[model samples]
Target: MPYDLKHVFASLPQMERGQSKVISGDPKGNNFLYTNGKCVIIRNIENPQIADVYTEHVHPVQVAKYAPSGFYIASGDSTGKVRIWDTTQKEHILKFEYQPLSGKVMDISWTEDSKRLAVVGDGREKFASVFLWDTGSSVGELTGHSKHINSVDIRQKRPYRIATASDDTTAGFFEGPPFKFKFTIREHNQFINCVRFSPDGTHFATAGADGQIFLYDGTKGELVRALGGEKAHSGGIYSISWSPDSSQLISASGDRTVKLWDVGSGSAVTTFSMGSGVNDQQLGCLWQNDHLLSVSLSGNINYLDKNQPTKPLRVIKGHTKSIHCLTVHKGDGRSYIYSGSSDGNITRWDSDLGLTECFSGKGHTNQVSSMCVNESEELVTCSMDDTVRFTATGGQEYSGDVVKMDSQPKSVSASGALTLAVCIGQIVLLKDKRKVFSSDSLDFEPEVGALQPGGAVAAVGDAEGKIHLYSVHGSSLAPEGPLLEARGKLTALGFSPDGAFLAALDDQKVLTVFTVADNYSVKGHFYGHHAKPVTLCWSPDSEHIATGGMDMNVIVWDVNDEDKRIKMPDCHRLHHVSGLAWIDAHTLVTTSHDSTVKQWTLTY
Candidate 1:
């Protein structure tokens, strides 16, 4: 037998309201990097779904910057520590570590030669530092600001220079091999949020919370001209990126707009309205190659189309928050994976190429608790928002058919055209979003629901450790057979693809399998988990069952031989597996609160 991890679909940039987020692109314009929690995500710019994550830092990471040479990456965290690691290998071995400041390191920059580095953030004694990249020795002092430094940049030419933007509303300039503060530009009436140098190294720009943009001579550290004269955006500018040719620039703002400007004319060339919602506010952006990318406060990344000013070519959507539920659908000769996050956003991904697209229209306003694919190739989802919705598989949008529940929906399962959902204390059956049947009354607290294959029988698990068997009528479920008892509260339930057996996971760390034809009696009990199992899926051929638990482990059990089990431990380090699905007979996909999704391949 052979089993190993295959690929990883990394999470989006962690976004927060009223906070500034930074996105950095490699020199070759191949990949982009951003910080999320304690991890730094690196994704292919061409195909955002192809990603890699570095999770070495213990503290929440604030910023990451790519070295000029594009071989090493340096990331800074809230603990004021910076770790430099090699990017050429999959392991990303750490090369060196340094304590740059005393508090959160908010921004980082690298010299053109990749020999020196600058970091700025909140520090008890000093707000920023400049050091030799490899030696971790002090190169110069970054002082002058009376408050936290929010941004930093380094000139890439012969006469290297440094600049910093601070909450004190001053933009400072420095010059040196051993850099030292030269002067302060007090042109802004509000805090400066971003400072960047043009690719040509001839000019630099500063964007401020006051909605103003000031251009300066990069080499002389003198004022050149103010772009847009009085202001560049209606709202505070969060970030700015220079075009490769150094002739134009793009700015992201809190006004929910992204604008392209001609640096020479100091006029806006085009303005792209992201949206009207508060989450539409632009937070960060990047100008690399032919792509002009911008990040909204919602964590959605937009690829702006200069030709079509009103609409972007694409909007990369995913959860910056934890994901709880997901399901796979295969139809029209294509495979799609739909995942719902804690924030209620749903994303559909092409299982083959990893291309992701977000659903449009109104969606769940809270966490989605369970999801399953139905006979029509549509997705049925239950949410904590007390609603169950039907979404089309190919259209990637809600079908406008929703059922409001009396209580929060806990779990949902579907077989053919029959759908069954377990709510707080009742079991409901629906067909095409219309209620077909409802349980008269319940004596047990239903925790989960499952529908046997071929749409014949429905099973409901209760907190009392009893599995209630139900015979599927046209639209309702009728009580049938005796109660299947468990050792603890039933947390999860699933049926084998062939509908010959049912599997139940309880709080007591035991998994009980029962034969469907044997009046749902216990066929066997598979046990070995150290903690409560939260999710389970069956192998395509019904020969194996995979389960992920609170112990941070995933186990592949051969149903015929309980002793033959494969345990993949510490799947997400410190996070529990929140959901699981089978991509194929030989592949398994797992997601965790850690904001990462891993795909594993098995050969037996």
Candidate 2:
């Protein structure tokens, strides 16, 4: 068996209502990066499909910047901790870690030599810190702004200089080897949001909430001119990205537009409207080679085409929220992974090719609680919106029949054409989206369920840590025998591929396996998971089982050998595993709240 990672489907940059999310592109113009939870995601500039995630941070990361040399990356988190790591290797080994501020570290900048770093953020005493990259030795002070700093950048040329944007409506400039505060420019009537030096270090620009872009000489920090003659953007400017030649720049704004500006001419060359919705507001921008990119408040990354200003060249879309459920459906010799996030968005991923295509029509309005592939090769999903939706296995739109669930659905399972959904107060059984049997007044509260592959048996777990077996009668279920009880409240349950065994997990952190052939007799009680395991799938050979838990660990248990198991600890950093599915007996896919889906090869 081969259990190593093959590919990662990275999450979209995390977005908030008013916060400006910072995105940085590498100097080499090959990759761009942003933060989602504790990880910094780096993806190819041209092919956004190829990505890598740095998960060494223990706190929620705010920003990540690639070194000028493109060999190292410095990322900062909510706790004001900055971690410098190697980007050339797969492990991303830690090079250095420093606590730059007492509060959140909002931004980081590296000098052209990559020998020094300046970090700025909200802190109790000082809002910024400047130190040597090799050692934490202090090199200078950033003390002009009274309020917390929002952005910072270091000049790339010889006469080293640093600039900072602040909530105080001012832009501060400094010169360094041992950086020292030079002067503060208070031309903006509103808060300054971003500042950046040109690639050639000949000039620098600052954009602010006042809707203005002020250009200045890089060496002397003298105000050169302001773009647009009036204001750069109609709404507050949030970010600016300088072109490689330092001759032009682009700014993203809350006005739902991105503008390309000629620095030397001080004129707007082109303007692109993102969309009218509030979520379409441009929050971040990047200029890499011929590709100009902007991040909308909705978390979609847009590729701006200078020749066609009205329409984007392409739009990269994915979930920006925590994923909660996932399942794998294999058909036509290809495996498709379906994932549902907390926001009700559903995406289908190709396991072998590492590709994704989101559904086209309107689907769930709220979080999708559970999903399974039914016998007729349709995806059956239940959600918090009080409805069930079905999508064709290979189609891009909803096939039209939407089943209105009687109550809040907690879990769902399907076997061929038969499906069983456990609602908060009801258990509804359906065939092809048509409700066949439903009972809202069960004696025990149904928590989770699993339907046998042959659609002959059903296992319903309740809050009392009991697994109730039922025989599939024409359209209804009949109790089979004594309940299989465990030590804690049952959380999840599944039947083995061969229909010979059944597995149930409870809050007590115990996984109890029972033999279906022996009147549901105890088969094994595995107890290695330190936390409640919510996701489980059996191998094709039915000899091994993989479980993912709230402890951020993925454990593969050997059924025949009680002492043998493989554990992958901290599988997705601070996020818990949302679900798991087997691509093959030797391959497994795990999705998590981190908004990432990972493919792992099992080695035996």
Candidate 3:
């Protein structure tokens, strides 16, 4: 008796990004933070692979300071959606949606008491507003700026002061819950990027695109002095941070440099130049305890601890595809990886083990669709859901209870610590039993054909003859559409043993190989045997490639020698071989539409 079944994978503890336990202090200068393109990430640091207390969000653009209690965080996104989530549980506790004018929220801040939060962004009615953190209630009205706000900061002491920087080239100062407008200071000729309060709450500083730095008495809002201008940075200054003693300030700029300035003398003390003159253009910076965390325009989060030199202590990475599978390796605390296609192929990978292993199995009944690889390397496939089954290297099968799907599962991928299943034309994400991120219109609506995930990259093939690539960054995710444009329908996709090469197939009966770091290309195409390739695989050494197609043949091609081709001479003489897998450098496996799985030995 066969039936469709949905099983609950055990739940592990959830982690929030920016949680104290995850990023207790700033990392050494060489480390960079990874984001899931939404709001989640693993914090790799001096410790041993800790995966807890990281940020999680749906449609979030940016998150604010941790409240004094450290129990929650205020996050805002491009849709003008603001949410307050429990830091420990990674759950959204409160939400504030302002779709009318919600552009990208540039920054958010919390007062010392943690009772109030301020959100500033590009909006229609108003550019900024102050609100209560616990409730979606407005506490103060935003005034003064006629342009987009770039940054905001709340004084964490008595006589609470809120300061905002804007593209209008001015800094606006206001007071509390009734947030009355104090006075506007015209200090910079360009946009002010950031404002910060000293730890003692006595003073603050502002850095702007004009390359100018200004310091003022926190209590008076009166200008104390202007330090550096055009001579300070060859480019715009994007973010600023303060030291514990309040004796010095650190500013990151578009010029690819970080400068430490002495408050009293208002002079540069030490300067650190990012390597190779790449000019990464640091855009965001934060000071936690004695360490400094800075964000670059290219989505890199850098940790700088003035005490260390050689390299960063750690680097965290993530992705945005609707996670379809997750396998945490036992014993060694390692994990392997696999993802299904939008059309119907399954790719296996060695993730946590530090090696690339892609196993191409008999494709899904429909499109090599949805899949899950457990600790045992047994992959469960869920296609149109008319049938649920498990597939292994030799095409082994486990009868799974069938649960019919309302629509074909177009794209299946995984993120965070969960697997996600996506239905066509739907934005809602099904996380086994829970629902995660979603949107109104995903813009592109092609039947997903193939999928694969590893090393911060998720590849999904679509009916539009395109393969989309997504890069997972901590909390800031974006999709690179049509990474590989095919001349025909992309039927399958895979990664080489080292993950350096991405393999793809099209209805044209061609096998295409690409460098994952770049675009899809002709690594080597199996043109000798198959008329229309249905599936492909890379040998264990990554030096050879195997392919199966409608021509009823299983062919192996030596990637290093394009002139030679190996053929099993109609291994499935009566039917098309629908799947293929390279078991080792000298052996392989195959499955045919004729409902047969065969083992084959590859001779030189």
Candidate 4:
């Protein structure tokens, strides 16, 4: 492998309305884990930008928990399979794999010694399973609830006990090493959403869709009291986490607020209002050491500030949807990667620092199809919403300067004061943030477009596998020379930074480069991708070109030497590469349908 993975900005946890997202913290309190698609993401509690992804699951993962010993993590998926892998190794080598049930595994709990495991979720014959961590031998009979279980927890102290919350509107209790169901507490009329035992192991709490919170004795399974009288929150309570000392706890509710409760007084101590929108609903929460984190229905992680109830200390944001386009911009002696997702989100990542921040204010309302940076250091972007927007990179905010296109834009390119947007059936040109000319009556349907670095010409690739050369005179594009032919339908087109070469990729898995100095003559043809190439970018020095394809491979081709290239296979496992950019001559940036942005360092 000539390229090594330098950094990974993992995606946020996938969110579902009316469902709780399980976020589990490691015993050392330094990191937390969550499930996103088939991968499990582990991020540092303090510097979340430092992250890792475990991608061994064959099914969409539902829950992941770090063992008490902190040596391994057991992740469960929708197929009811649980994989226990080592945490100490970078490979996360699998220690064991077991299928505990026949359906989705909603939650998993490990005993204090980390030797026993309890798994529960929607199953056909059984709703819960308790077995030894090493051998798949049954350690207990976890039965009592008649419906699917939502949560499970084991007492961390002596006389280990088990507790579960279920859709049957009941909480079940169990006891002993060979655990057996002791009794069922039916205190709520609605489905239970979460169950947890205090750190001290003296009491346990259960919350439900009825917005009720019930406290029970951990040792005897006796009702201790309700947290907030009849109801703990104005809306359904989804999750609760106890403070390290076990004297207080925080609960996330669908009412768009997380409340801190004093266990002894059974009253709310502080209320953290998330927002008023439907996407602001709080879904999950965790109290790790001094940090209080909560997840919103929008998949953003909020850091709660006790003194400031109205605003969080920090809100971590990233793509919760697949990324569709990417562009790199260099300004103020630093490089930044701007990524656009299918859900119309544009996030800016600091290439050197691995830090991320999103553009503020209303921007694109649909998927951003293409992006480019102009001489003014402004980001010019086109979207499926029929508009081209110019956003300021320095301020990291949308400028609101927009150019409406005649049709949905397929690609956009910018150089100096000239911007070209190739739409479904139109070729629109803009100068100084305003539309100057648009040609709706063209002979070919443009699939992609690129403007020369000197703004002298515009190259538009059409569905007919030909590149139309249009000379840019003022604002209008005049047809130039004969059309450049390709082997198949064009997928991507780009002009070299130095204006010496033009690169085009096609559905035929071929890369063709043309020497602009030699009357647009063929420079060389490269082939390596196993599938259709979707995106391409030129190196800063114009010496190399990088292409990403549907085959999940990224190949760097040397323009001077057609036979010399670097091939990186499986760049993003199980997902096609959607976009590619160059941070520097030696560094490559790639985005994929997996919703993650990765940086790779090229050895050559």
Top model number, TM-score: 4
Better of 2 and 4 by lDDT: 4
Candidate 4 lDDT by residue in tens digits, 1-604? 6889999998999999999999989999999999889889999999998899998999999999999999999999999999999999999999999999999999999999999999999989799999998999998899988899999999999899999999999999999889999999999899999999999998999999999999999899899999999889989999999999999999999999999999999999999999999989999999999999999998999999999999999988889888999999998899999999888889999898777798877889999888988999898888989999999889967887988887899889999999999999999999999889888888888999999998999999999899999999997889997789888999999999999889999999999999887989998889889899999999999999999988999989999998999998988996888999999899999999888999999988
lDDT of candidate model 4 versus the reference: 0.93
**TM-score of every candidate:** 0.94, 0.94, 0.51, 0.97
Order of all candidates by TM-score, from best down to worst?
4, 1, 2, 3
Cα-lDDT of candidate 2 = 0.89
Off by over 4 Å in 2: 331-333, 398-400, 559-564
Q: Which should have the higher lDDT, number 1 or number 3?
A: 1
10 residues in a row with least lDDT, candidate 1: 1-10
Ranking by lDDT: 4, 2, 1, 3
lDDT of 2 by residue, 87-200 (tens): 999899999999989989988999899989999999997999999988989999989888999999999988899999999999899987788888898889998989999999
Q: Give per-residue lDDT, candidate 3, residue 220.
A: 80
lDDT of 3 by residue, 172-210 (tens): 988876687899989789878788788777888888887
Report the alpha-carbon TM-score of model 4 versus the true structure. 0.97
Q: Which regions in candidate 3 have their CA more than 4 angstroms from the true location? A: 1-36, 42-60, 90-101, 277-279, 305-490, 493-604
Query: What lDDT is obtained when candidate 3 is compared to the true structure?
Result: 0.57
Candidate 1, residue 297: the lDDT equals 92
In each prediction, how many residue pairs overlap at the backbone (N, C-alpha, C within less than 3 A)? 0, 10, 42, 0
In order, the Cα lDDT scores of the candidates are 0.88, 0.89, 0.57, 0.93
RMSD of 4: 1.5
Q: Model 1: how far is 73 from its true place, Å?
A: 0.9
